[model samples]
Target: MDITSQKSAEEASGRYCGILAHPTSFPSPYGIGDLGKGAFDFIDFLKKSGQSLWQLLPTGPTGFGNSPYQLFSAFAGQPLLISPDRLRESDLLKKDDFLDIPYFPRDSVDYGAVIKFKTKLLRKAFSNFQKMNNADLCAEYDVFCEKHSFWLEDYTLFMAAKEAHNGIEWLSWEDSLALLSPSGKAAWKAKLASETDYHAFVQFIFYKQWFELKEYANSNGIRIIGDIPIFAALDSADVWACRELFNLDSKGFPVSVAGVPPDYFSTTGQLWGNPLYDWDFHRNDCYSWWISRVRHQLELYDFVRIDHFRGFEAYWSIPFGSTTAENGHWVKGPGKELFLALEKELGRNLPIIAEDLGVITPEVDDLRDSFHFPGMKVLQFAFTDGRDNTLMPHYFKSNCVCYTGTHDNDTTLGWYGGLDTRTQDWVRRYMNTGGSLINWAFIRTALGSVAKYAIIPLQDVLSLGSESRMNTPGTRDGNWVWRYYQKDLSAELASHMKQLTELYGRHPETSVWHEQSGFATLNSRGPQS
Candidate 1:
């Protein structure tokens, strides 16, 4: 697909297949995957596998223990994911500079080492840019910063200030500085002007490299799907810059935080702790902040997957003093009005997928269906309750998107192996196949579903077990660390995926499959309801 050829919501409505793998999972020599060869290679794999979309987690600069959902700036890219190789190609880095870094693990990210080493290298590159400036690059950097200054100015300042303060949270700073008074901000800007400019320089490099990679993917008939977290970190540039948008105290701390109540995933519930949006404040301005956020994301991706989509309908608000998510109340969100504002600003309904997985209410479904955005259905969630579960293939609707597993879940094989015998038996009978080749079986089932888009996590595609899982919810460490080796994207696996996609009529040329072949016929089915 040419970047211009990407289908608008009006252009194509059904049977488009995709894959779920964050760019961080791409194979790379760097401590983590980056916007480099690994990214381009993965795009090639997507094209070869007859896939049209590549869905990724949020690319934001992670905050508070490396969760993408909690980011330093909702608008900025993770600088650590910026490719040093690309920098070298641009003559901003020397080969020897990369060589002296401590050896990094090939299979997982070492966040601490990667952060320290990359920060130092980025500073060096900034210094080099200052010394030997190219007129064209300088012009480009000016244009980039000017174009993004709405958010970039604050983000760059926040990053520079955080570094100056030895990585303390912004709330720990002095009252005037922390609250971002006009004089205080101006004084700080003058004092840290060099560091601020360097941070802006890094962002310019990141965007340039990423846009090139995105161009490569589009030229090869692949659309990039980007993720957007609905909440922002309390210690973020966003909160620091726009305190009125959140439920914060006079001192600029969250009065109430965001989290989910007890659900299938946990007994204590998950205390995300990110500041909740003050929907009334957003409503007063016709959701201008959200409109800008969505517009910015649409600039970077063909499609955006809204994480925790149900939160837009009704969000769980946890008290600021709570240790766990146990004590929280469901608060109304700026539902239809927000989307109306988005549509009015963009002149069309946005292309989005709703992460409507847990504790879904009818209102959530109403909100999703009203906008014609697809809701996700996970196959792993299906087998736990037999074939009749809403997540099962037989229960999927063509407007939905199906996934074998997601970043937060265990790989299919690992999840299956851990199931009790009765549940395993239920799965075997549900698909009418033995558990001998469960991974492929699950893939086949997902592909053959009524869902318009079918996605499989890279771990499930490689049939890897728990250790390869990208994340385990509620855990601080050992998450977002998985990496794939080049060998994992073998010709054999691509061929198999292509065959399954074609067999299920999910190829780009077809819209739906009327013929059911391998999977069992369930209690009632035409198109799943």
Candidate 2:
């Protein structure tokens, strides 16, 4: 798709609804989700459920305890997510090769064993590709490299160097290589050319499999939404290659890190250790790095959600060596200047959803509204104090998006069941219903809101509890490993979702509820005939 020809604000103002299910949540026999049959099946499920959007977490190669936000390379796809089944169909793998693997748990991903097993399989597939001598695939690989060489070459080299150094962080390498000197880079490239090409070939297959899945979804009226974190991991290829783009010290460590100050959620505040961007350097370059980042994402997604949107207006900067986020101070950010540059370069107002959940200042709201980007409202945050909280559905504007629960929150049922009596009573009173139907009630409220888009986490839609939660913000272990079995997505669930979506005018254009006078179209001009 040509992102430059995206719909204007007016054309995009439709009552689109979707589900938030990361690719990892898709069912697979590989012990983790991959770009395989499970992915295509999930897309079919979304189409049957009357959904048009399929929101996903960052698809980058994860690092540092397997968190997607802390990636090895901002531009590289997770090689572990490449589908063995797809490789087999393409004649690069065989079923007999996978027959000896140990049984994997169906309910959750075991990243450790899965990584070991998948890497071995990927190596075999790479060997097969080298020997098969298929001119067509080799030609396609060349085209892929040319199209993505801007980032791919560097990422492939970075991974090759990491392997050469036995997986040590880049900063710990020899001084010349750590600093990315010209002589050091050229020498390493010459010595490790084969390893670099192998990694690049892996990316070629990963992207090929991913685009095939994405094309299937789009053909079925399902749009894929991708995520972009506000900050990059300190130990990333992006920061290592472009040191001047971030606030790194002489030793290539963050001088001042990024985090949020104490908010209503916690007394100590959230300390996100991602490195801070050097806005001055970025502004001097007219945000060319940012433009490339957004451009890369637009190629893979129909819409992009900018996580930690508040940071763009004013970021919380913790002084070097701080133990907690409480010591951070709010620093001014690049703000509208960055957006204007993006608009000029992209030649279109990008479809961005602001994660305006934390301590949002008026400046942040103004920045988000200026571009007419939809801001997010999570329902789980609504009943904390009372039904009158800002996150409540009744207070949402038309240019906003609402969620029953986000990845960071416990599943809706778990949240409601664990709430205090006062909070639970307030929630019940607000909806005028018992708590037995809390998940459905929240889903209905979000869909019936004035917000233009309503998204429900797949866990919430399935009415799962804490066991299905995607992540816990401050924890490092036991995150991003949840999975669902194929049987979990039953015909009954699809039928239920279809009825609710049709009732609330969220179905595709042809299935709207015409008789319901209360059903207003998303745009001011009202429903189509």
Q: Number of the top candidate by TM-score?
A: 2
Which lDDT tens digits does candidate 1 get at residues 1-529?
A: 3222244633365576778888777777768888988988898888887888898999989976788888999999999889988899988988888878788888998888888889888988998899876999899988998999999999999999998998999999988779888888999999999999999999999999989999998888787889999899888999998999999999988889998988767889999999988888999988999988988998898888999999999999999989999999999998888898888887554678899989899999999999888899998888666456777777677888889988899888889989889888988887777777687788888888888888888887777888898888877888998999987888767766666676787766544444553323321111111
Candidate 2, clashing residue pairs? none
- List lDDT for all candidates, in order: 0.84, 0.85
Least accurate 10 contiguous residues by lDDT in model 2:
520-529
- Residue 91 Cα positional deviation in candidate 1, in Å, after optimal superposition: 1.0
lDDT of 2 by residue, 178-256 (tens): 8887888889889899899889999999999989998999899988889999899888889888899999899899989
Cα deviation at 260, candidate 2, in Å, is: 1.1
Clashing residue pairs, backbone N/CA/C < 3 A, model 1: 1-221
Q: Which runs of model 2 end up more than 4 angstroms from their true locations?
A: 9-11, 514-529
Number of clashes recorded per candidate:
1, 0
What TM-score would each prediction reach against the true structure? 0.94, 0.95
